[model samples]
Target: MEGRQLQQVLNPQRLKALQEWMQKSSITLTQVNGQRKYGGPPPGWQGPVPGPGCEVFISQIPRDVYEDRLIPLFQSVGIIYEFRLMMNFSGQNRGFAYAKYGDPVTASTAVMTLHHYRLPDGGCLTVRKSTEKRQLRLGDLPTNINQVKLLTLLRMVSDGVEDVMLKMAGPKGREVVALVNYSSHYAASMAKKVLMQAFKKHCGISITVKWTSFSKSKHVSETEQEDGTSTPPGLNPFPKPSISPPHLHPQPFLHNVPAHPPLQSSFSAVGGPAGPPRDEMKPQGPVNCDTVSLLQWMCEVHRLGTPQYEIRYHHASSDGFLCFSYEVLIPCFLIPLYGVIQILPGPSAQATKEEVYRAVAELVIQTICKVSSLRPF
Candidate 1:
């Protein structure tokens, strides 16, 4: 059983026949070679100790709505043993989480009756039976966000974030790029949910949202695929959110923040060639010596004019992170680092820096989207 190949292991069979045979036959069917047993321990044998309770998962709820708004809604369906909103690595909501009831019957009742119940905000809530653990993101933040901002914001959300990185990128003068990394992928997903709600506080700037990890690589939509990292986010493996008891804590206010890097980088080079200088870089989770660094093969950025800049993240390293980038050459342009977006008035007239920036920010915001807020999706 340990080293046997598929050809030598359990014989592939019609699932229906196997199910019928298993139910009728007192003799257990080990496999192609009959080396294992597929039955309970013994007649009067008791099962091993039970661990955590099964989870009842819920997803797609908008974050601005709070725990108070939710508890009663669920209670209307069944007596919940416990309830909680899961936080992510960046302190955002993962748009999904879990709940638990005192018994399986109660959990089942909720699944059947309240799985798709409507929220006060008028969004469909998706619920399901689950057994996995729910990772917490900690708290909330503004929705007009990027990865870096989320990581920073979530440290305030909970105590578990050991490390995280959020990045944002896109063409200069266009929407700049941003993504947030969490010490745990679970934490990152939760942060995204909470951040979208909290960040939407600004007048008309709702941060665009998407997810990438070792698993599903594509953004939540075609729009979020600006910096495509293939079909998967690298190596993410997903375990759905499960049910559990709830835990609450008084959240913090926005006014308080750690001494931040005066994020003065200009809008012209948003999510540009070189990511923020590797200041206090946090190494990813521990790996064996064989685990290599996922750094760039080659990269360089060249500004041609106001509408364009050349960038290259060549996947030069044969077996390394297949990194690559593109160059912009539209109204040729060059934007200085740490400045506002400067849409040069003409081909090469010294851009009235302030005026140019204001114009560009307005245009990019308009083109990408006019989203004032984001509810759960």
Candidate 2:
């Protein structure tokens, strides 16, 4: 039976017809920040927001498949609260998506019923409970980093930092460890991906980052309270730094702009007379290859003035991923480049803006490298 379904999906003519049918159907699909959402809190939904364990992570979908087929199949188990399929720029599915139900029991039913369910493209879906872990443990931090300062730094470099607690680690308490809480699991996951690199690049610090189990984190908090080492209620931990880093200064040019406007409708800036000598722009020593730094270096080497950016926050998903649309005006380019990025919710608008800036910078650099005949680097 599954083989027959696979045959039907693989038939070019039938697949085309199926796609055409879906296009004409009333199902509303919207693309936002790299994900194709069928229904965010599906239409007519009146239930309370889903809690932990209410979502199932699904994988092994065929790239050609879309929500048209997947949604109805999953609906057999329970009412879907939301469905998001990660999409590629090339108009293909990323072979994985998320299906959220209204309650944990329904979510579990999805896993039990859908796990290893065969798809029409000869793929067996891998369905499981979403971990939804929302805390991270950062180790080997500078011993001098107090909770307040560390919290500030984390907010600057990453999004969705909710709280920070510091503790001594290593022999003789020579090292500091921070247990950071993010507003959502997605935020904690994003921070885990970039915290080490961000710390090294921006703060010149090498630290360890790892996901902490809730039980482990709870134990640590309890221990701190018992030892009377926790920060007192209503008291600030550590004094604010006297001087802020130059690079950490907020970019004044960034502001909310209309999203998805035509290229000609967006702001554009032409390159001014070359600012600095070419050699000064290109680092004499080993270059920092991180996206933002690398793009800045490239702009300098090519004599383009500093890049200008505009970022706008869109709606966040029920799962806690904040979506943003961004545009970067490279002085050398004829038009600004724009795209979407999703990150965990940030503590402030500025933190979210910084994440979008890095994302758009990387996109611009890639575009330049792809189109330039001569190697710019």
Best TM-score goes to which candidate?
Answer: 2
Candidate 1 residue-wise lDDT, 129-162, digit = tens: 4422122222222435455555565577533354
Estimate, for each residue in 8-62, the C-alpha lDDT of model 2 and write its tens digit.
6465664575567667866677786667777656678895766444667777688
Question: Model 1 reaches what TM-score against the true structure?
Answer: 0.24
Which candidate gets the maximum lDDT versus the true structure?
2
Q: Give the range of the ten consecutive residues with the poorest summed lDDT in model 1.
A: 290-299
Off by over 4 Å in 1: 1-53, 88-92, 133-377
| Candidate 2 pairs with clashing backbones | 160-345, 160-346
lDDT agreement of model 1 with the native: 0.34
User: What count of clashes does model 2 give?
Assistant: 2
